[model samples]
Target: MANTWNTDNAGVSALASGDFDGDGHDDLALGECREIADENIDDPCGPEEFAKGGGIHVHYGNATPGSFGYRQQTLNQDTVGVAGVAETGDRFGAALAVADIDNDGRDDLIAGAPGEAIGTRAGAGAATLLFGGPTGLVDAWGEGHSVGYQQDTPRVPGVAEAADAFGAAVATGDYNHDGKADVAIGSPGENAGSGGVWLLPRASVNGSSAFTPAKLGLPSPSSALAYGRYLSSQ
Candidate 1:
């Protein structure tokens, strides 16, 4: 709870809740999509930090209603075991989703950085996966923990294009009627601004290899639709 408020332009732009510690009480994840970094453990938002690098803060819950535990941790690309680098406009926590992606009973976290650059393509977008463990969120899963996915990634479909904004929104569900959860990433700027959604099944995610994805309900180019701008799951 220390240093929770600062002048770092750390906007709480996104949020998710789950039993990340397996402690029965649901924990909260707050996304500061416009955060800049000082990396000062005592004060991340101190004067030294100023830019839109983005980050997420986890607040473990207490047994008492509307209460959080003493433990709090903030995550960003700079954190050990996390993927990518904390850069201006990465916006790492612009969108977030929680699910038992590995089907290991513990719910995992998926964070979207819609403004991330891919290769030389600015704003090509990306998403990061973090596993949930007994202690809390960890990037320790052998196969796919703390992995970053973009259009040109091995298992992910499509080509990396500028201003695609692929991770503008995110959601999870059993899209293929499988027992494990699948991920859907939104690219609101894809295909000349028509927008697109990519569906990655559990098997594809587990394999960490190239696989074809179902492009959910796409509208024609002339329709001028941003089809994947927002998403939610039951």
Candidate 2:
């Protein structure tokens, strides 16, 4: 059987799959990282609108073979369940990670918007966590739906600088051996271009509280190291 899925504006820049609905069938998340200015005329985004941002789409699975059906959800900064306002250059779905972060027997989602700017700190980057609910992934920001997190030099305890490009990469694992999964966010533009990574504990994430992450970096004095450019859990 041949199954195909499609989205507008050359979507599907990134892809990840898991049992997002807890129904035994796997679901897919597609990252549409570029927003087209005009679909009718195919107009390109102007310099001022470079930060118009993009979005992610979740396709729920069905019992039918090779079918996701029409049950789907769209997510972005502007989405009802998402936290924070959608801003230009956020690239909300640039990178994705899925796992049972809360030990709820349901898969959760993590999306990296490495282009997201914080205050005057352009490209400071951000990430969003969407928890799965009884029916499936919560479609909007609410009591149990979504939370946004970011890495800053002050709170994350690392090299201080702007345009750090945090959230450029993400990974989850039991870094503390606590049985619960933890997240590691990579900032490839930190330390005057040396890069760094921050580890967020599972407890902190589950509690939905502010946390001071443990930063990691290389021992060398090399510039432009980009240590956390990519990450994975063993």
Candidate 3:
């Protein structure tokens, strides 16, 4: 038998599956990258409320097909485990990636908000890590041992800049030959559209101190290359 899950939004922009709760049953992550506007008001929102970000919904799997049960939880910038507040144009769920980023047995979640604005940098973009725990995905800064990180946090590197689109894309692998997994984030709007990528080592994500990220950029003399527009790892 087949089953269907639906959201209020018309377009379900992205999808990812994994054992997010470590129950051995596969779970699904759905990204709704567009905001649903209230039609009642002609100008429903102000500048900061327009396109007020999107959301990531997690549906835990069941032993029986077509009976996966209701959505376990909904995730967004304002979610307790998430690192930031939902903002206009953040598009928080534009991209999604899953891995055991903290080297824990349970898989964690990475969400990309390419339109996220940092400070005064509108559309600078951001990404967040929602660590898994005994009770399933928990807050990064909440109590009871949930590992978490955000692009704007000191624990990670780099700040959001205007039009950086920092979380345009994301991928994971053991880039340093370490047993733990690492993350690579794409910023296609950097350097006057030349673009760039930031490598966040597993150590850095799991560490407490601030660190600089290892950045990749197009070679000199190349303008508007947008090198890190997309990324992948072996």
**Best candidate (score: lDDT):** 1
| Better TM-score candidate (2, 3) | 2
Residue 109 lDDT, candidate 2, scale 0-100: 76
The TM-score of candidate 2 is 0.77
Best candidate, TM-score: 1
Give the CA lDDT, 0 to 100, for residue 53 in model 2: 75
lDDT by candidate, in order shown: 0.70, 0.65, 0.62
lDDT of 2 at 161: 48
Tens digits of per-residue lDDT for model 3, 36-68: 455553321122232357776667787887555
**Model 3 C-alpha lDDT versus the unseen true structure:** 0.62
Residue-level lDDT tens digits of model 1 in 1-234: 111111223456677888777777778877654434345344432222423477777788988898874566567777767788888888887888888777676778878898899888999898888877876784334222476788888756678899989888877777777666787888888777777787777625444322222244333333346657787854
lDDT string, candidate 2, 54-155, tens digits: 676677888887777347666677766676667877777777777787777778877778788888778888778888876666543433378777754334
List ranges where model 1 is wrong by over 4 Å. 1-10, 33-52, 138-145, 203-220
RMSD per model, one decimal: 6.0, 6.2, 6.7
User: If both were scored by lDDT, which would come out higher, candidate 2 or candidate 3?
Assistant: 2
